[model samples]
Target chain A: MDSIEHQDHPDRELLEMLQEAEAKVEQLRVELDRRREFRRQMRADEAHEGTDEEVERLSEYLEQAQINWQAVRKFFQSAIEEYRADDAWGSGRPGA
Target chain B: MSQTIRDESTDSEHGVRQIEVDGADTAAPASPLRRLPLTGRPLRIVEWLAVVAAIYVMITAVGAIGSGFEAATGGQAEELFSFASNPFVALVIGILATALTQSSSTTTSIVVGMVAGGLPIEIAIPMLMGANVGTTMTSTLVSLGAASDREQFRRAFSAASVHDMFNLLAVAILLPIELIFGVLGTIADWFAQLTTGTDGGIVTTIFTAFGDAVSAVTSPGADLIEAAVMGILPEVIGGVLMILLGIALILLIIKFIANMLKSLLVGRAERIFHAAIGRGPISGIGSGALITVMVQSSSTTTSLTVPMAASGKFSLWQIYPFTVGANIGTTMTAMIAAFGFSGVEGTAAMTAAAVHLIYNLFSATIIFAVPFLRPLPVKGAKWLGDLGAKNKMYVLFWLGGLFIVLPAVLIGVSTWVF
Candidate 1:
């Protein structure tokens, strides 16, 4: 009679385990949101610290740096994209 | 409960897919670097056409001078060169004409033509020697650009003047031997005979073709100019005009070509010189030969090297082989001149040119191959450079005396006494 009762109660334990996992996932999502907001505020503060001329010059330099980085990133990303596209096409599937 | 679980799994998968799509879209745009559709500038076409036009103008100018010479001489071209019968006078004329024109080719071609037209080889040989000496003046003149900077001027002038010293030394050593023993002349004549089956040889054949082509273009205009000027001004006036025009054309061509080359090859040339200097004398000689060949003039090669030397990019030792190589390279003009005449006369003229080439080659072989002879010119040049550094006026005097005053005095005395 005791064995029969243990078998019938298995679904309850499974539900409790799922609830615990969902709670952990929610905590992780909140941490990620805080990190993103902190990064955005730091960037805004940096953008506000200079006199107009100095700010303009800094902005120009930052823009150029950004452009260069973007160019480099684009080059690598495009290469990867090309490889993936080629592989997918070669496999005769839409997103292989 | 199973349905709820399935919905949650699907939602997470959809979120992950959304994030990936967003990341892909945010990955910066493809490289803005595109291959420029236009491979070369349009101005290149204009530059090439300009070069072609300049060449045509140069040929025309040369034609004009030939016509003027024919008109001035009035079929007495042979009589006109009678003064060159004296070897010393011929040598002086060679030096003066080349100095005035600033071109060894012009002087050499004239000498070859004169020789082919019945001027004695003995007379032409001296002229050939004079052309060798006179060619050095171009670099000497080039040194003047650095005159404002005393230290630079001293170095540049010395480098430029060293060529004059070398040529003078060669002439001093070889000329007396040539006059007394006829060693160079004999050897040259023998070689000429072997190659051309006559003293004037194959070079004369080429010169004849050149002369004919020149005559065909210029004779009609020359005849008309002669007819117009014969009564009003002396025939000499027309000749003078021709000479002037020829000179102007040559100067213009040289200036343009030099600027073009400097713009095109100066960076590469600097690198090459730096590398060649480290490789030693053989490399130096090869560099000198190659640069002169590309420039089509040894004076240009030597003159260009002076500035590099002045700037301390090269030492006197490195430059020595270059000068020797230039001496050999310059004789190519005379060979080209030989092609302008035909028959026995052309052969003789070509032989004279060959003599010039052989003389330089032999001198290089003797000086460079043997350790003893190599340092003489270098030592002399350094000594002169030291003197030039102390008294800047010495540069002018050296040029004036060696290329001008001395040659003129020697020729005048020879003419008077002989």
Candidate 2:
């Protein structure tokens, strides 16, 4: 069956929640990529200056971004998992 | 039958797909010589032969220095090096010489030759200790490359400084013990006697014969080279010219040998680093010693760890034993140079080389055995690195004080005043 057809089943709310969680995951992925690219550029720029302070600042920024990414990723993962569980329960087929 | 958790063939999978890209012969593409049949084996043999030749050249260069020193000073080199009578001054000379040259192997080899030429064994002992301390500067210098990145610098510097701290600590503990007890020196004398044998014994005769052959072949060419250099320079500078030429030859030959050995053994080195270094300290020490002995350069071996540590693939503790092993391994050059002399000179030279080996062995046994003492170098290195990360100037100060300022000041004072 098409994913859209599955979305229209009795557990429509759970399916919609799943769709939203997926969108959030994609968004986070894009954000992570952008952050990584920005950090890469910052590193390249800091290399030319070759100062310790700029390098330290860049390191701190990357660490904070990693924490933010982990939090967002964990949130979306739980949301998607919960949607899957509810939809399965409502359909009366736990394995499916 | 067991079911797979993730199947890459499935088109609907949403998680990161397992891309099946072949590993692409990424292991440094084989050269044209390697691609050719039969020629590759011959080339490998030639490389090994070249390594042997390099060692021979190094030994001849060391012998040249000894002979040159004797020629330069007219049998009075001993009086000039009399300042080395003081252990502290001698130690400083060793450290300064090694730091300046960037190779303890070269420094110790030169020291061995000097001893054979007439530098006192007691004086050479402290210099040997200094060489150990001086060699650690190479890795510390390498760690400076990571300074631009704070975290990397922290890891790299700590990794690098553990070598420094360990050697310093070793000298701090052992040098005094040596000064008071002469324990290491006495044992070295015993060992040197056993191995070198009497003047007419087999070992001495063999060494004497070999020395004769080497001198016969190299002395003429060496005299010619000295004459050519002296022709341009004044008569006053002839001795200095020959000594400098010998040292330059030593450094160049060693660099060439180390590079050749690295290329020859890089694959084995990779396997050893990956599989053996992480197993335990014993394995790590073994691998470290093995690689250093293979390359004939502890600087090459220890400086190698800075990048690995900087990448965060390895920790300072893991690299610590390897550094210790490097300390032990670098004694091989001096040991080999010991044979270049005959009779009493050979015995004295061998004694100095033995001192180097015994000192490292004793230091490794004592420091690594005591759990409390074991972590001191690692902790001290980390602390210094942490401070360096906050302010890069701390590392600069450390490098300057330990390697440059301290050695330079000590050497100057020792030369004129001592």
Candidate 3:
């Protein structure tokens, strides 16, 4: 909703933050939905990063004592995971 | 099933360390240069056979050490081990021995054997506690492996060092109380006696039968080794030789067995962690204990958590309970090794083993149950990790200084002082 409509609301400040560049209530709604979708995509990427294949790979690295490489690669993988999430948000659709 | 676990790091792109894996290749791990024993069905069987042989060697090693000490000391065991008479010195010995071998199971097994042979119970207890502290070194180093990647190194170091903090805290809390009150030993002694029974009875008979079964398998090898050594040298020298041989066998055989078991069981461990890590602390602890038992090393258990922690998938608090479970799990080896002796010696060996188990359980229970104590390890690890990212030198000091150099210095100073 517009900042004017939420003047007496408990989350008025939050609405105003979202409405900073947008004037109409419809535009504010789209902004909130977009943010929500972005968060959902980030969570999905996190789950994918923790998949069984990755666990298997991590376990093998550790068992073989390639610990330094494991840590470094996983660091790279974390950056990649976050990057994918951000990329999806920028493209306006995941896997675009 | 031959598994391609590691492809060596090469500069595929200028800045990247492309140490990739083929998920398609499934089964076992081999080092970069060697084929290892994971090649096929027959080889897997051979690997398992080697693991079984390692257990036998481990048992006989404990026995050989016990009997070897008996021969060398000629009933002067206390005088021979007089250096460890100081509890602090004994503690340092435990730390140094375990740190050197990188396996607390080996150190504790030897300690149990020594205790059975006549090392003072009081001296052995501190050494056992020190083993717990020393065992954290390998995983802590695993965390330090990421020194070039500061953020990952910091978080990974925190995850790895949490175990170090917990064990250090446990020793700090328990050692003084243990020295003064003899709380752990009293319970252990009572339990040992109750199970073994000084007087002839059904319980004692059953215990004797079981001990005989164990001794029957181990003593022949130990006696044969002792006799061979004795034939080549004087009794005292042979005893010393046997002690060295036993220590070497325990160390080398354990590493060999650990590698094979890791190859065979890493899949199970990975599966368990995936299923259990997010479930809560108890699930984390139980899975940690289970995997350590399966793979036969707490270092393996804790080391497996490092990459996950570094990746930021699991927080340090989530990893803490698992490492705590690992401390408890490693006592299983010592308990099995205790069976190397039978009759009265067996009772003492078992008693020392019991003390190791009880101490871990008691420490874990006390730390977890007390609200104030629970967060100490996680907090301490986080602090060290934050520091480690900024100053790599401090990480070296913590790893080498606390685990090795500090213990050695204490032992040296104690020798001159007391």
**Using lDDT as the measure, what is the rank order of every candidate, best first?**
3, 2, 1
lDDT of each: 0.59, 0.71, 0.77
Show model 2 residue runs off by greater than 4 Å.
Answer: A1-96, B1-39, B199-237, B408-418
The segments of candidate 1 whose C-alpha lies over 4 angstroms from its true place after superposition are A1-96, B1-71, B74-78, B116-118, B144-151, B181-248, B261-275, B337-349, B412-417
Q: Could you give the candidate ranking by TM-score, starting with the highest? A: 3, 2, 1
Per-candidate interface DockQ score: 0.01, 0.01, 0.09
Colliding pairs, model 3: none
Classify candidate 2 by CAPRI docking class: incorrect
Q: What DockQ score does model 3 reach against the true complex?
A: 0.09
Candidate that scores best on DockQ: 3
- Per-residue lDDT tens digits for candidate 1, residues B140-239, read 7676555445577567767876677778877877777788888777887765555444334566455455656644554454345445545576677866
Let me know the DockQ for model 2.
0.01
Classified by CAPRI criteria, candidate 3 counts as incorrect
Chain A TM-score per model, please list them: 0.42, 0.43, 0.31
lDDT of 2 at A35: 100
Against the true structure, what is every candidate's RMSD?
A: 28.8, 21.2, 12.7
* Model 2 Cα lDDT, one tens digit per residue, A1-96: 546467457777778899999999999999999999999878645433322222122212212211133433443343345346743212344322
Worst-scoring 10-residue span by lDDT in model 3 chain B: B10-19
- Kindly list the interface RMSD, in angstroms, of each predicted candidate in the order they appear: 29.4, 20.6, 10.2
lDDT of 3 by residue, B1-418 (tens): 1234353332322312233344443434542213442334455566678788889999999999998888888888888778778988989888878877889989999998888888878889999999988888778767756555668878888988898999989998999899889999999887777666576677877876777798899899999999899998999999889999999999888777777776666555656766774566778778888877887788877876776678776778778998999988898898888877887898899889999999998998899989999999999999998876655545656776887687878778867877
